[model samples]
Target: MAQGEPEAEILLNTIESQTLAVIDRLNRAILMLVTGQPTVSGYSAMVGTLRPSFDQIAQYAPRWGDLIPDAPHIRAELAYLLSQRGPLDRLQTPHLWAALGLDQESVRQIYQSRYGDLPSSERTRPTAAAAPKTEPPSLPWIDASLFQSLQNELQPIYLPSGKALFRQGDPGDSLYLISNGRVKVVVGEGETAKTVAEFGQNALVGEMSLLSGGNRSASVYAIRDSELFRLPKASFERLVEHHPRLMLEVAKVISTRLENATSGKPRADQALSLAVIPAGDGADLGAFCDQLVESLRTHFDCAHLSRAHLDSALGEGIVDAPLGTLRESRLISWLAVQSELYPCLVYSADPTLTEWTKRCIRQADRVLVVGEGRGTPDLNPIERALFEGDSFHPEIRKELVLLHQGGQAPQHTQRWLAHRQVADYHHLDPHNRAHFDRYARFLVGRPLGLVLSGGSVRGFAHIGVLRALREAGIPVDIIGGTSAGSLIGAQAAMGWDDVRMEQENKALFKNVRRLIDLTLPVTSFAAGKGFSSLLKQIFGDHLIEDLWIKYFCVSADLTAAQLRIHRTGLIRRYVRASSAIPAALPPVLDDGHLLVDGGLMNNLPVLPMVEIIKSGTVIAVDVSNPFYTADGAYNYGDPENGDSLPFGKVLRGRVLSRTLVTPSLVGILLRCLEIGTINMESVQIPKVDLYIRPPVDDIGSGDVSSMDKLIQLGYETAHQQLKGWKGRPPA
Candidate 1:
C-alpha cells in the first residue's frame, strides 16, 4: 500500500462503475433491437459513448493489468461496436452477443430476467460482421516505458463532462496527461469566461504553472468525460532530473504559447497595429516601412498610416499634442477600433522626436525599432527615454529590426541585443523583398524556420547554404538540425557566419586522424572523446536558448526509443549527443538516456520547426547522401591497377586512406543508416516550403579533406535553387 493507494482504488472503482453503466446501456439498446424496436440510433449512440472510455482503458490497461481484468475484453468489444457502420438489424442476436463478449445463454437469461421471454425476432437477424483491427497511433513524445516505471506514483483521475479540473488562481501542484476525451482552457468566470484553447488525448496541460511555481493562470474543464494520469510536481521534478530533454520540450511549449499570446494568428478582422520607430539617427524608416507594408500585403490587408495619412483619416490635428490630452485618447480609441476594418496597420513614426511619433508609439500594439546594421547600434535619446520610462505601456510588444543595404551578415547585432528587452530581433536588407516577406510572416505570428539535415562531414555544405540564404537577404527566425547539422546550426545560431564556419571547419579537421580514438569493440569503434572535445572548444558552456537566434537540435534517445529535441540545455553536450553516430562514435549518456545521432530517426528535422512556428515557410537544407546500393563500386582506380594520379590527388588519398578504408562493418552500418535517413527525408522534405538538396552525393560522409569544394557546391546549389525567390539571376 502506498500513500495514494486509496485514491487509486477509488479511481479504479469509479472507472469500473462507468464501464458497467456503458455496458448496461449497450445491453438495453441491443435488447430493444431484438424486440423489433430497431433501436439503431440508440445502439450507435452507446457505441459512440463507449469510444473515449475504451481508448482511455486501452492506453493504461497494460500498466494497470490485473486491477482491471476485463478492460481488454471491453476494449475489444468497443472496437467492434465502434467499427460497425450499419444498424443492429443486420447482426444476428447470438452473433451480436458474442461480438459484445456476452455469452448467448447469459444474454438470453439476462433478457428473460429483465424483460419477458426472448423475442422470436432474434432468430431471423443477419450474421454479425467481424471486428476490424486497428493499430494505435504513434506518439513519439510519450514514453510508455517511462510511464510504466512511474506507474505506482501516477494517480489516475476521471474528469466528467463540464467538470473543472482546476480553476484559475488554484495552487498548481501537478500536471495532467490526457489519456482520453477533450478539455477546454478558459480564463475568467461566469459571463466573462472565454475558452482560449482546447486540448485532446495525449496533450499535456497544467505544466506551465507547475514549471513556473505559480498559481494556475487559467481554468481547465473537461469538455467531455475524460480520463487523465496526474503527475504531481515531485514526480515531474524527478522525471525531469532523469530526462532533462523533457524540460526542453516543455520550454518549447511555453515559448510557443508566449509567441501565440504576443502575436496571435492573423485574422481578416484582426487589427495588428505596428509602430516603426527609428533606433538611431538616419535609419531610413520610410523605406523600411514601405517594404514591410508591401510584403504584408501579400498575406494581409495591410495599410501604411503615416502622420499625414493619419491626420487626414482621423481629422485629428497632431499639432503639439500632449501625452495625456483628451484628443490623444480619442485618437487612440479610433485607432484601436480600426482592427475591425483591417488585418494589419503599419504606423510609420517620424524619425525625429515629434507629437506624431509619440502618438504612433502610444497607439501601437507592437513596436519595431529600426536601426542601420552598419552604423553604431545605439538607440535615439527619445526612444531610449520612452523605453525606460514608467509611462511606457508594459504590454506593448517591442522588437529591434536592424536594416542592411546589401546582402551582408548582420554587424554589431550582439551589442544591440545585449541589454535590449525586446520580444525578438531581425536583420533585413530594406531593398530585399524576401527579407520583408520573412519579416511580414514574423509580424503575423508565422516565422520562417530553417532545418539543416545531417550528413557527417558533408554538413559543411550547410555553411555555404547559410551563406547563400544570407546573401539572398532571407531571414531565419528559428533553426533546428540533427547530428552534423546540429554542430553547424549551433554555430550559426551563435552568430558564426559562413566564412567563420568554413575557417573553423578547416582548422578543426586539419588533422583528420586525431578525430578518431579507437575504443573497446563493445560500444563503438571510437569513444568520441576527441569529437566531444572539439565541440566543447567551439561552444563551451553556452546554452541552446542563449543562442543569438532561436535554435533546437534533435538526438535519438536509445534509452527511451524516441527522438529528443534539445532546446534549452548546454549546447555542447546536446550537439555531442546529436552527432554521436552509432558504431562510429559511442552514444552520449546524459541523465540516464543513451543519446545517439538524431539522423538515425530524423535526418531532416523539419517537424520540430513546424511544430514550434505553427504556420510559416520552412526551408530544409538536406545534405544527406543518396541511398547506397551494393552494386556500386567502392574502388576508385585501385593502386594495384597502376592508374596514373596527380600529386595532389595522391597526397589527399594517402591522408584519407587511414580514415576511409575499404567499407567494413562500420561502413555497412552507416549505409543502412543512410538508407533509413533518406526514406525519412522523402516523407519530411515535402512538408517544408523549400527543400535545398546540395549536390554533395559524390562526397563521402567521412570526407573532410574537400571542405572548400563541398561548401562551394552547397553555395552554388542554394543560389540556383533560390534565384527565383528574388526574381533575379544569382550573383
Candidate 2:
C-alpha cells in the first residue's frame, strides 16, 4: 500500500503481540480500546487481522519526537508532530510517548490523510475510542479456527437411547464430551429433580468443574447411557496453559450457556384483561368475551399449576385450543398488525384464526383480520367507531387480534388440548420496548417508569432530567442514554463532584451487591443459600489462606495471569489472616487508596439484564468503568463482581430551567415524579445503611468444611477466626 506500509503493520503487530502477553491485566485497562478478546493471543491475532479505527487514530496522532526539551512526555518535536491539540497529557511522565516509541503526529496525519478529522467530540480525548461496529460475539474468533488445533483433545461419546452414564453425586474430575445420544442434566436438592438441560451427543456435562476447578457445580445424570469423549482435568489444563486460543472457543460457549441457564425461558409481556360485566338490561354477552380474555391470558402468559412454563399447555387433555391455529395464520395476522400502526384494533370476516395471528399481535407485529371469509368481519363496534373518527384506516387492510369477539370460541384453542407445542418463537423482541412492557406487571416497578433516551434524533428529553437533578443536588444513577441522554450529558458529564461522589459510594457498593448476585450461580441447586452468601464465601475470611499481603486484581480466569510480566497478577487478593473486610460506616478506603476518587476508581458493573430489558439505571442497567457505550451497555472483564470489592457510582446534579427541555433533562425530571411503585429491591450492597451489618459475604466455612476437600479443590483454608465459629473436630 505504501513504501513503509509493511513496517508500520509489523510495528503495530509487535505491540499487539506484546500487549497480549499481559492479557489478563490488559483486559482491566484496554477492554474496549481493542475488540474481540480478553485473551492476549486472541486480541493480538485480531489486531493482525482487522485494522481497527484505533490504528488509524494512532497514525493520525503519532508521537511528536524521540526526546523532549521540556516535559519530556510532552516534547516539542513529538508535540509538533502528534499534538493536533498539543501534548501527550495522559502518561504520568513527559516524553513517555516517545519512550513507548509512538509518534502521535504520524497517527494524526494518517487519520487526516485517510479518514479525515474525526468528529470534534471524538477528537477531544485520547480515551474517546470509537466502538467496534461488529457485535461482541460476532467480532471474530467466537466460532473461528482458533480452536481447530486442539480438535483431537475433544473426545466424543455416544449413548444408547435410554441409559445412565453418571448418576448424581458420582465424583469425577473429568468433563464428558458428547459425540452422540440424548442426555439430561438434572439438578435439585434431594428428591425434587429439575432437568436443567437436555443434551444430545456433542454436549458437555461437567465442564464447569473443569473451568472453575470445583466439584461438579450441578449433579449430572444420563437420561440414556450416552457415549461421550471425556476431557480429563489434566488434558483440559494442559490445553488451556499451552494453547490459549482454545480457551476463547470455550469462553464463548460457556458465557452463552451461563446466560441461557439463568434466563430459563424467554419472557413475555403480561396481557391486559378486557373485562366487561355486561349491560344490566341487555344481558351479559361480554361474559363470553371476558372468559375469552381469561383463556387467552392463560395461553399467552403460559400459566400453569406447578410451573409458569409456557409449554405446559400441550398435555393430553380437554381444553380449548389457542387462537388462530393455521398454516399461514401468522403471516395473515401480521398483515393486520402492520395496518394498525396508529394504535387501533382490527377485525376479520370468518373469526377463525391461526397460531401466527396471535403471535403477530402479541409481539407488536402487524396483524390482519381474515373475517371476510366467514361473514364475520373482525371489527368490534368500538373499533368501528374509532375507525369512523379521525384515526380510520383504509377499508381494505387492518390490524386486529380478536377476530371472534362475537361470544364464540375460536377454532385454534384446541391445539393446547390436542398437542403440547413449546415453540421457539424465533425473534429479537426481547430487547424491544413493547416486548419488555409485557413483563411490566411482574417487574419491580409497576407502571414502569423509564427514562428512555438515545437515538439519532430527540437527544434532549433526557438531558433536561439530568440538568434538574444536578440543580437539586440529588444523587442519581443512570442507565441507557439515547434521545433523552443526548440532551442531558451534564448529569453524565458533571457527575464528578465530591459530595455527590461521597453519598454515591455506598450506593455503588450496593450495586456491587447486585452485580455479584446476578453474575454468580446463586440460584444453583448446589448453592444452599442464594448468591449473597456465596459472594460472602469468596470475599469472606474463609477465602483461600494467607490472602493478607498484597493487592489482588480480578480477571475472568485467574490462571491466565501466569502470562503477566511479574508473578503478582494471579493473587485473588491479599487477605491478611483473620482480617475483616472494610465495613466502615461510610466512605471507607482500600489499601490506603480512596476507592472513590470523586471521579476516578469507578468500577462500573455493566448490566446485561438491563440492556436486554432496556432500563435506565446505571447499576441496575449496565455500565463500563470510566468508559461505557454511548447507549450505556457495559463491556469488559468481571471486576465489578470481584470478591467483595466495592464500586462507586458518580452522579450529576445541575440546575436547568423548565423551558430548557432536553431528553437528558427529562430523564432527571421524571425521576422525581411518583410514576408508581416498584416491587424490585436492589441486589447490591444489601440495603445496608448501618455500620454493624455484616458484609454480605460468608466467612465461617473453613472450620466446618473438610480440610482434605479444600486442599483437593485447590482452595487454601483461611483461618477459622470468624466470631461465631469453634473449630469442629474433623471426622
Candidate 3:
C-alpha cells in the first residue's frame, strides 16, 4: 500500500465510530421522549441528551448537505427545542413534538392522559383572553331545568318489544318523551304498512297529534324494550303557555317532517335504486357496472341485476316471467321487491335496448348516464327518445358519469350534459379501483366540495392545485371561496381548465399596473374600477347562478357586520365585492348592502360549503401565510459565512425583516387580517376531509412577481399530499 494509507484508514474509522455513537445517543433520546412518562425530570434529561447529539449532528450538516437535505429542518427543530423554557412547557407544546418528527396525536393523547383535556385558555392560545366570559345561550328544548320540570309532571311507562304504544286513529291525548331504547312510527297496516320514521333516546314522539288536537297521524310501536315519559294534553298545554319557545321548536320539527314527506325525496334510512345507462357506443358499460357493484359492496348491501342477470333469473324460474311479458304493475312490484332485498340495487342497462332501458329508468331513484370522456358526446337516437319520451319520469335524478383511462381530464362534458337534463357530472378513471370507490360514495350522496382560501396574489397557487387535482382524478363537485379565492373559483366554476386558468393568470398578472386605479386614499388606495374592469373582461356580465359548476363566494357585509354568501348575483360585482380589501379597495354596494373582502371574516369559507352540501367530502386548500414561531420571528438572523438555513426559515426571516424594519399602515392592517384568518382556518380546516397547505410561506400576499413559482409549489404540494386521499363517505 502507499505510505500513510494505513494511518488515513485508521483516522476515518475513528471518525465513523464517533459518529455512530452520537447517532445511537440521539436515537435513545428520541425514544425516551416518545415512550417515556411525560415527567418533567425525565423529559429534561432527554432534552439535555438531545442537545449535544443534535449539535454534533449539525456539525456534519455542511458536508452531507446534498445527501441529507433535511439537515437544516432538523437544526430548526433542535433550535425550537432548546429555546423552550422548561420540560413541562415543551411537553405541553404539541407543535414542538410534531416538529421533532413525533406523532402529534400520540403526543396529545399522552399529555391529556396526565393533564386531562387542555383548558380553554390553552385551547384558544393568544385569543383566549378575547373570548367573552358568558354562559352560552341555551334553547328551551335542550334546557335541563325545563326537561326536569316536564318530567316532574309526567309518569314513566315501560314499553315491551312488539307492543303498540298507540294505534293509528287513536285520540290525541298525550305526547311521549323517549328516555331509552327505540321505536318505529308506521302508517297504514299489514303489507301496506311503512315505517316512515324511527325514534330513540331523548326523542319526542306523537307531538303532531297533541299539537293539532286531533287523532294520531301514525301508529307508534316499541321495536325494542323502552321507557317513555307520558305528558298529558292538559300538561302540554300548560307547559306551552309557560315556555312558548318549546312549541316553536316542536313545530319546527313537525314542519321539517312534513316538508320531507312532500319533497318526494327518500329518507336517509331508505334503499336507493340506481340505473347505469351507457350514453354512447364503445362505452365499457358491463365493466363499469361490475366495478360500481364491487365498490358499492364496500359500504352497502348492494345487488347488481343486469340484463344478463335478469335473463339468468328468468331461465332459472326465479323470475316468474320475462320482463317484457310482465304487466306494468307486476314489474313495479318486482322492482320494489328488489329494492327491499338490497340497500342498494344497481340496474345496468344497454342504451340500444329501448324497452329494457325504459324499464330500468322507470324503476330507478337515480339514473347515471355513462360516457367515454374522450369519445363523441352525442347520444344515440334511441337513448334520446327514451329519455325525452313520456315513459321517462321527470322526478328521476339524472347525472352524467364520464369514464376516462390513463388520467385524462374530462373533455366535452358540457356537450354530453346538453344531450340530456343532467343534475350533475363526474369524471372517473375506469381502471382505478379507488376511483370507483370514490364514485360509489358519491352515488350514496356524499359529494366532494373544494374550498379555496384567499391570499390575494398567493391565490394564484390555487390554479396549480386544481391542475394537480384534475391530474390525480380528485373530483370537486362543489366549490366555495373568499376574496382572491372567489376570483379563481369563479373561473373554475365557469369551466376554465387548469391550463386555461394558468394561461389566464399569467396574462393577467404579467402587468400588475393594469389592476391598479389610484385614487385619493379617503376610502381606499385604489378606486376598484380597474379590478372591476378586469373581472368584467373575464366574466362579461355572467350571473353567479349561471356558472357551469355549483359554486358560491363569501363577502363581508359592512352594513350588517356579518358575512354574506353570494350564490346568485352578477358574477363580476360580487367577485369584486369579495375581493375588495378594506382600506385598500372601496366596499361594493350590492343588494342594498355594502360588502368588503370576505378575508376580513372567513378566508377559507369551508363552513358555507358544509352548510350547502350538508353531507359530503370537503377538501380545503389554504394558501394563507405560513405559521412561524415567536422565536423564529424575533431571533432569526443572518447565517455565518458558508452556513445555510432551511428554506422556510429564510423565507420567514425575509418576511419578518421587511415588516419589522419599516412597517406601513396598510401592512399592519393586512398582517392583522392575516392573523385573524389563520386562526379561523385552524378551526375550519379540521372539519374537512382533506386540508392542503402549499409551501408558499415566503411568498407574500401582494407578491405577484413569482406567480409561476407559487403555482408550481401548489401543484407539487397537492400531488404529494393527495397521494393517499381516498375520500370518506358522509357520516
Candidate 4:
C-alpha cells in the first residue's frame, strides 16, 4: 500500500531478465542516480527515466526494494509510471527534494553557520544550491511518508570535479546526501587518497562524523558535477524517529561502498564502533536511580495510536506537537540520560543479541555472574533465554575440545587441531610436545588473536589475560554469543549490519572488511550461532555472495604501503567463486616448503616472501611467486640448475617441517637469520587479514634491558629460539 511498492514489484520483474554481469552494472548505475549531484549535472533524456530503471533493477534485486535507486533512463520511466513526472528528470536544481517536500528556511540559515566564522567574503567556497522540498513526516517508519517529508526540507548544492567538499579531521556541522554528481572518498590520515570510493546521487555522507562529534574519518571531494542535500544533526535525529526505516536503508548503501573500497578493514570511524566498550562496576552505584531507570522505556505504542487516544491521554495543557513526536522524544531523552548515568553500552541484534556481549567480555576488567541458570518476569522476555545457559565451550579448558563434542574434527581441522589434544603433553612425542610449546613462542613476539563467546561473563582473571594480551599488542576479535554485551570482533570487524549503525558506522565496518580481505591471508572459519540459518534468512539462495570474507588493517602495527606490498603477493589469484581458490590459480605449494615450492599460485608477477635459515652467513634473498608453467602443467624446475616452469618450480620433493608455526615467530626467525636488527628498535608492522596476533605466553632469557612483566614471564627465551630457528624447510 506504500507509494512505491506496487510500482517496485513491477520494476523487479524487469531486472530479472538481465545477464549476470549486467546486474552488477545496473546496481552501480542505480546507486549513481540516488547519489549524483543535482545542481551542477546536465540531465539527459537518456538519464531521466526513474520508472523504467526501477523496473529493471526490480527484475533482479527485487527484495532489494525501492531503496535501491533507479538508473537514469529507468528513473525517468518510473517517474512517468508513478505519475510523478518532473522530479525524476536529470536536473541540477531544487526540483528533486522539492518534489517530496523538506524545510527551506531552516536549511539556508544552516548554510551560513560560519563553521569557522570565516569573513563573509572568504566564505564563498562554491556554495550549495537550493535543495528539493520535503515536509515533516505524518507517520513513523513508513518510507513513502518520510520521503514526502524530506521532499519539502532541503537546499541543493552541486560540486564540480576537484572541488574540496571537506577535509579529514575537519569539524562536522552538516551531513550531505548526493543528488547528481560523483564524489570520491580519500582516507589515511590526510596523507594521500590511496583507495578511492565513488558516490553519486542518493549516497549519504558526513553523518557519522557529525553524530559522533569525531574528526572526519576520510576526506570527501567531488569527481564529476554533483547535486547534494545537506541534513543537519537536529533534522537528522527528528527524521530518524519519524522514519527509522529510511535512515537505516541510507546507512546500508554507504556501508556497502566503504566495505568495497577498503576490502574489509573499515575507515577509522568504523573501527571505534566495532571495538569493545569498557566494563567496570560503579563504586557509588545502586539505590534509587530514577534517571537510570527512565531510559529503558519506548514510545512505539504512542506513535501508532490514533489522534483521539493521544488527545484524551495528554489533554489540552500539553505542548502542541504531534502526539507521536512528543512521546518518542520523551522516551529518547530519558534513555539518553540513563545511558550517560549507567556508563554501559547496548545494541540491538538481528537473529540473536551477541555482538554487544562479545565486546563486554573483551573490555570488562571483571565480570560477576548474577543469574541462576533461568530467567523470571524480573528480566525482559528475551533476556532469560539468551543468558540462562552455556552455548559454547569455555575460552580455555586446558584440553577438552574433542571429548566434549560428539565426533572428531573432519579433515579440515587436522593440521589446525593437532596439538593441545591432551591435558598434559608429557606422554606425547617430544617433537609434538615442543610443537605445543611453539605456540607460546609464536605468541611472544607477535600480537595474539583472543576470541570470546557464550552467554555468561568470565571472571576477572580472564579480563587480566586479555589486558596482558592487549599490552603485548594482541588484536582480540571477540565473537559474542547471545546475551548481555554481544558486540564482538567480527561485528566490530565488519561494523554492524545494514539496519544497525545507521549510515556512518556501517561505512566504517565496510571499509574495515575491504582492507582485511585484500590484505590478509583468508582461511575459512567455522560458523558460530548457526550462521547458516542467519545467512539463509537474509540472503536467500545466494549465501556465498552475501556472507563475505573481509580483511582488516591494524593501524598501530604497520604502514599502509608495507601492507600493500605483502597483499600484492596474495589477492590477484583469488578465484572469486564459492568453492574457494580461484580456477586461475592452481595450488603452488602442497609440498609445504616456504623456500622451494612447485608451481606458482597465479601467473601474475609478485615478490614472494623468501625464507632465511641460520646458516651462519646467507644473504637475504627474494624469490618470485608467479604462477608460471614452463612445461605448463608438469613443473620440473630443479633449483640446482635453475630450470623452472611457467606455473612454478618444484625444487624439492618435500619440505622439512618443525611443525606448528606461528606468524610472529616466523617473522622473528626470518629477521634474525637475515642478520636484520634483532634488538629492540621502534619498528611498525604492516597489517594483513586473517592472521591472528600471537599472544605473549613466554619470554626468552637473552632479552636484555628494562624487561617488562611479560619479558620476566620467560616469553622471550622461546622468542629467541624461534628467531634462531635452525630447522630445514617444512617437510
Candidate that would win on lDDT: 1
Write model 3 residue lDDT over 286-366, tens digit each, in one string: 898889889888776788877688666433432334453322223333443354345688888765755677666655657
Best by TM-score: 3
Residue-level lDDT of model 4, residues 86-117, one tens digit each, is 21222221233232111233322332241212
lDDT, model 3:
0.65
Better of 1 and 4 by lDDT: 1
Reference-based lDDT, each prediction: 0.66, 0.29, 0.65, 0.28
lDDT of 2 by residue, 1-731 (tens): 53334433333333333222212122211221122122243333232234333332232222212111222222222323334433344442223344433345654464455535523323444554333222122234333222332333544344543345665665667776543234566676567977665554234467666667665545554433334566667776786787575566666666665664564232221212111111111122223233332333422331111111112422222112343332122222222222211111212111222332222223221122212112333334333332343322122113222222332322332221122121111111212332223222222112111222221112211233333333433333222222112112222422233234323322433433333222233322122123234234333422121111111111111123110111121111211100111111012123343221111111111222232232222211111111112533422224566722122221111232222212232232222121111112233212211101111112121121222221222111111111222321111
Candidate 1 lDDT by residue in tens digits, 593-653? 9998898888888877776666566788988765446434454455667855456765687
* Candidate 4 structure, TM-score to reference: 0.24
Each candidate's TM vs. the true structure?
0.46, 0.22, 0.47, 0.24
> In model 3, how large is the Cα lDDT of residue 621?
89
> Alpha-carbon error at 95 in model 3, in Å?
69
Off by over 4 Å in 4: 1-141, 186-202, 215-218, 245-262, 265-731
